[model samples]
Target: MTLRPIRLLAGAALSLALASCGTTYSMPGIADETNSRASTMFAEAKTAAPRSPISESAGVNRFARVARRIEPVARQLCETELAQGKAVDCDVKLELDREMQQRNAYFTYAEAGNRSPVIRFSVPLLQDTGNDDEVAFIMGHEYGHLIGRHIQKGQQQAIAGALILGVITAAASAQGGGYYDQTAVENSMELGAMVGQRAYSQTYELESDMLGTRISHAAGYDPVKGAQFFARDEAARSGGGQLSFWGTHPPDEKRMAMVLATMEQIQGQQALTRKASQ
Candidate 1:
């Protein structure tokens, strides 16, 4: 459901305490779709697809290595470019034994969404062949979440949804003299919330892809080459029948296009030794 539906439910009471609440989605159809577009885009650039990385416990170390390489650059980029002159006050911690056995690296603010915002990566490298570029790119992807401010924005969206929902319900009951159509009210509220949420959450990914590109470039890594990892994987998994490339992420083709466009802009700056001040 979209976030707009949630907000409508909250209705006009958002002035109050709005605080509250709240892929690859790579099932069968998902992968095949990614493969077609991601594959073509990468192939045109002569970028070879990568085999699936190992998925065992041994792989975490590999993921960690990649995260380490990119963390410095990602943090620096945020502080210098995205943070708007705010200092980045956070830490990166590695684990040799995680009880939950999570397969992915994650980003968590040290402040826990309160004050000192921090983004942490918590996965080891792939257990398969240790491709640092791919691993770093993976790390870059998680870090991309923070650069995009998905964390805080996500919280705000949730609260907005909840606030709208509560207000809508309360107001409907009051206006209807304690008699309201439950189904109609529910359907309307849900639809509105979904629209609002999607607009805020889903659309930011392309911009994040662009931001990630700038990050990879600044870190002294090959953003173009690093992107090849996603390009190759997206195409292979997308197989040949998937429909939307952005089943979860930015569509493979769209992401490729954005990254390329961003590359052109940055390379021009590099040639001129241009430095970003904000």
Candidate 2:
């Protein structure tokens, strides 16, 4: 194939891949006022004294309480989205991770049996939370990942990226000779996949935060307080050098700003609803 055709094919593949990924809901824009407030909050959190870790029993109790409240609310939201014709799985299983030492939580599909979606919170991470609001927020955020179908979208992006890059590499190699360099094409595909996965990760995190805010608020938890968990200056990796919660959910002023903006938006929506009801 000619270079022009090869370029066109790669562009088409990339466009298709990108079309599959991204937030279904509108992401709130950060206003200047919200950004300033978030900056202040972030700065204050960095200087604030570290919260003492709770005992295992206390942690477990807090988790149970928060989970009890947040789960139903999250599920209801998921069901609503499904009813709106969103291709999302509303059935979510919340589980505690007893083995991992790192402070982290995640949502993923179970490897065995039916690929059921499960959200797991590590024991250490639970113990590290300052309050139930923090726990509720974290749980809500994980639920956002499910509602947003981020994992599924990410898989599509990776496949598209790999395909696009692989094709480009193969076509380039075939330009001089009729043969393509298999190893080079494979390497390019791997690189492209990594890029695709990482590219929208920050955006995904913010999207989750927005959804989490709504879920937590509906569940009667204070999302602003819950989001303070992100303000802390924590290490990205654990003692063993593995990626921890901070590694995945990096603390950022923009995230705090997004939360603030989302909360304002929610309040505005509530006011409108109340006015209409009256």
* TM-score, one value per model: 0.60, 0.93
Give the total clashing residue pairs for model 1.
Answer: 47
| Model 2 whole-model lDDT (C-alpha atoms) | 0.85
* Candidate 2 global TM-score: 0.93
**lDDT (Cα, tens digit) per residue for candidate 2, span 59-164:** 8899899999999999998999889998887888889999988889999999998888999999888878888888888899999999998998888788788878
lDDT of 1 by residue, 86-145 (tens): 334434443333433223345555546555544333332244233555455545655666
The per-residue C-alpha lDDT of model 2 at residue 91 equals 83
Runs in model 2 lying further than 4 Å from the true structure: 1-12, 235-243
Q: Candidate 1: where is the Cα deviation over 4 Å?
A: 1-64, 81-89, 92-103, 109-125, 128-130, 169-196, 233-250, 274-278
**Consecutive 10-residue window with the lowest summed lDDT within model 2:** 235-244
